[model samples]
Target: MSFSSIAAAARPRYGLSCALAALCLSYSLHANANTPPKIGGAPVTSVTAAHYYSFQPWASDTDGDKLTFSVSNKPLWASFDSSTGRLSGTPIPPANVGTFTNIVISVSDGTYRASLSAFSVTVRSLVNSPPLISGTPATTAAVSQPYSFQPAATDPNGLRIVFGISNKPAWLSFDSTTGRLYGTPGATNAGAYPNILISAYDGYFKATLPSFAISVTVTQASNGT
Candidate 1:
């Protein structure tokens, strides 16, 4: 292009104040990720409490609002607190080991802006055999009472537990897909099942956990729902 044209185009951005401001913005955004932000801290996580743990983040933005936490890959049993930026919960039960868990914790102004952070969780159960149970939930049914079963257990490997109520009443069913022990009861009152067996896994090695056995407990309801 022409020399005069180039000078004219650079005029606006070349001003002393504008150049300095742009330089500052570039430096701020490129700061080290490990450098703590305002709520300055680390995305700390742990996995010692019954295949469960918490994740919290440090804040670093200009706003004064609180931080928040959450999970993405492993389904957690507890909820996140936005006000304190803490994530306390049980990672999916029966603790399968060695699985790669990814969770996202986002901090925001509660308006239109938010920043996301990620965490990884690993599980390890102490036993080899799934948990075992001595008694099962009742097979009896009421008009609206469907029975549910959640097995009790003991892992030979001593792994942490995530369980299931395997042997359910006619009205009830075990969610082989999600481990949700649920079902409906239409008429039965009692059954031959005195105990229910569930396979539980522990957080072991890279698995974060392995399997074990657990007993089931039954409750009553109506629809096989």
Candidate 2:
């Protein structure tokens, strides 16, 4: 073959090979652009009540595309900052004190999206303060007479208070829910009762008041002359 004819034959094949390589590169780039972003982060297990809490999640796209972050099923006391991929807020007491599960943190690269559900957050209850018993109970009672009194108490956490009594006399009845002590003493029950104890509870903690004594006197019956 002549030199011109050989060069002409090789030119077509070289051009075809270049075209095939360009097509393959174009397809690779397109595929990478469609790849989803990978989401990654750890969950906070515990946070103090009424305190600020914050956590940042991470995401990346293989194609270097811009990513956006979001969250779902977040607690009402907290919020997710989509622009910064941060979860932050202050949690209230009691109502916010519990384990929260399956908070979905998601990331998207416009065309594709990814999610991480491994994060669970816990808002711990505030330290409980002992309930306080207020005032002293009356130390005297009359036989066959009705008596009723409620021991005053307070809880620093605003929790409901329960009342209890120890070494109670048979004539006296105690109410745990309302903290009331009430009952009628029989005529034969006239006597001195000592070391009667009263206590208060605020669900998680308790406090007791000092001991006191009660004297029940007999009622004199009227006789017609």
**Best candidate, TM-score-wise?**
2
lDDT of 1 by residue, 110-197 (tens): 4433444455656554344434433353444345455455444455545555544434444456764334456543344333443444
Report the C-alpha lDDT of model 2 over 76-158, residue by residue, as the tens digit.
Answer: 88888887688888787888988888788888889887988766788987987788887678888887778776778888867
Specify the poorest-scoring 10-residue window by lDDT in model 2.
216-225
Q: Which parts of model 2 are misplaced by more than 4 Å?
A: 1-101, 104-120, 221-225
Off by over 4 Å in 1: 1-40, 44-52, 60-74, 91-100, 111-116, 128-225
Taken over the whole model, the C-alpha lDDT of each candidate is 0.49, 0.82
Separately for all candidates shown, the number of backbone clashes (residues 3 or more apart, or on different chains) is 75, 0
Angstrom error at residue 59, model 2:
29
